[model samples]
Target: MKFTSEEDTYSWAVEFGKSLQPGDKVAMFGNLGAGKTVISRGVCKGLGFEGSVCSPTYTILHEYPNNPPIFHFDLYRLEGGADLYEVGLDPDYLSQGISLIEWPERLEGNDPGLTHIIRIEILNETEREITLEKI
Candidate 1:
């Protein structure tokens, strides 16, 4: 879908996220400023989280306080699957609640049974094409 603004992208994600289940894992692909975080924030909102949802880039992960909770991850700093494992990205950890990952390309061989894959392509300064593929 074509989004003219970040809010549009966020709204789309909110609606999409409402359909997600407890064990669902989402893989998000996008470059810097591509609205990945915006979409994620929307998902958190849809999941009933009212607090701020920031990027977990430096922190590695952010766990929301909502029921069932939301495990948001940023793997931009990780070298590979091994590094991911070091940060408790294993099945046991992800199985605790819903997982949303950014820069999932870093986790190449480690597919955590992703339920949805979303790619946000930057078309222009304020335009983004967000594509969702259910796996």
Candidate 2:
């Protein structure tokens, strides 16, 4: 899907979030400022979260208290696989709630079943192409 504005991108994410279930993992691949956090905010909204949703870059992971819980992770600042393990995000969060991971390329071999991978590409300053694939 092509998003012409941030709102458009967020709306798409809200819709996608409605279809998510517990124990589901969504891997989001995108460059910085590609609206990844916007999409995540929409997901939190759709999941009934009423608080702010920010990128967990420094914190590694942020947990939201929604119906099924939302585990938002950003691996941009992570140095290596050990960082992920140290955060207790390897196999535990995968089975606990809905996991949305940004910069998922870092988790190369940790393939959680029934995963949805969303790749966001910046076509231009006002255009973003998002492709969601399930594996």
Candidate 3:
């Protein structure tokens, strides 16, 4: 799908979020300023959460308060899956709730339960293409 505005991207993500269940893991792919956070917030909104939904680029992880919880992770600064495990992004930790990971290419091997993947391709300053895949 193509989105011309952030609002649209977010709105679509909200609906996507509604279909999520606990333990559902999502991988988000995009460059800097690619509206990944916007989609994350939309998904949270769909999951009946309302609050700040910023990327955890520095902190690496943001746990939102919710029934099942939302584990938002940013691997922009991480090196590999070993770093992920060190930061508690292991299977045991991710199984507790929904997990949204950005820059998931850093993940080594196939982390279980990572069934949903979303990739955002920038078409221009205000246009983007969103692709979703399930494994």
Candidate 4:
């Protein structure tokens, strides 16, 4: 998908988010400032989260109390899945709700429940190439 602006990306993501359900997991892949959090916000909006959605970079995770709950994880500073444990993430919560993971490469463990993978490539200063695939 070619997104000429952030609104385009967020709009597309909102539609995608509406299709998610409990146990759904989405992994976001892109470089720094690639608008991962923007997509996340759109997803949360589509999921009926009325509050704000911000990046969990410093906090590592942000839990939104939606219908199925939203476990938003930013693993940019972490090394692997083991680090997730150290950060107080229960492996079981992943299956009970929706999950959005940034820097998913840090999660070395197998995530069979992951339902979607969103890869964004920067095409220029104002354009982005996004690929959304279902698992």
Q: List the residue pairs that clash in candidate 1.
A: none
Model 2, range 1-135, lDDT digits (tens) per residue?
Answer: 888999999988888998898888888889999988998999888888899999999998999988898999888886655445665576665576888888877766655453898999999999999999987
Best by the TM-score measure: 1
lDDT score of model 4?
A: 0.87
lDDT of 4 by residue, 1-135 (tens): 999999999998889889999889899999998989999999999898989999999999899998989999888988666455565456686777899988888878745357899999999998999999999
Question: TM-scores across all candidates?
Answer: 0.94, 0.91, 0.93, 0.91
lDDT of 3 by residue, 72-124 (tens): 98888888664556766778877878998888887776465687999999999
Score residue 7 of candidate 4 by CA lDDT: 96
Q: For candidate 3, which ten residues in a row score worst on lDDT? A: 80-89
The residue-level lDDT of candidate 3 at 30 comes to: 94
State the TM-score for model 3.
0.93
Better candidate by lDDT, 3 or 4: 3
Per lDDT, the best of the predicted structures is 3
lDDT comparing candidate 1 with the true structure: 0.87
Q: lDDT of all the models against the reference?
A: 0.87, 0.84, 0.88, 0.87
* Clash list (residue pairs), candidate 4: none
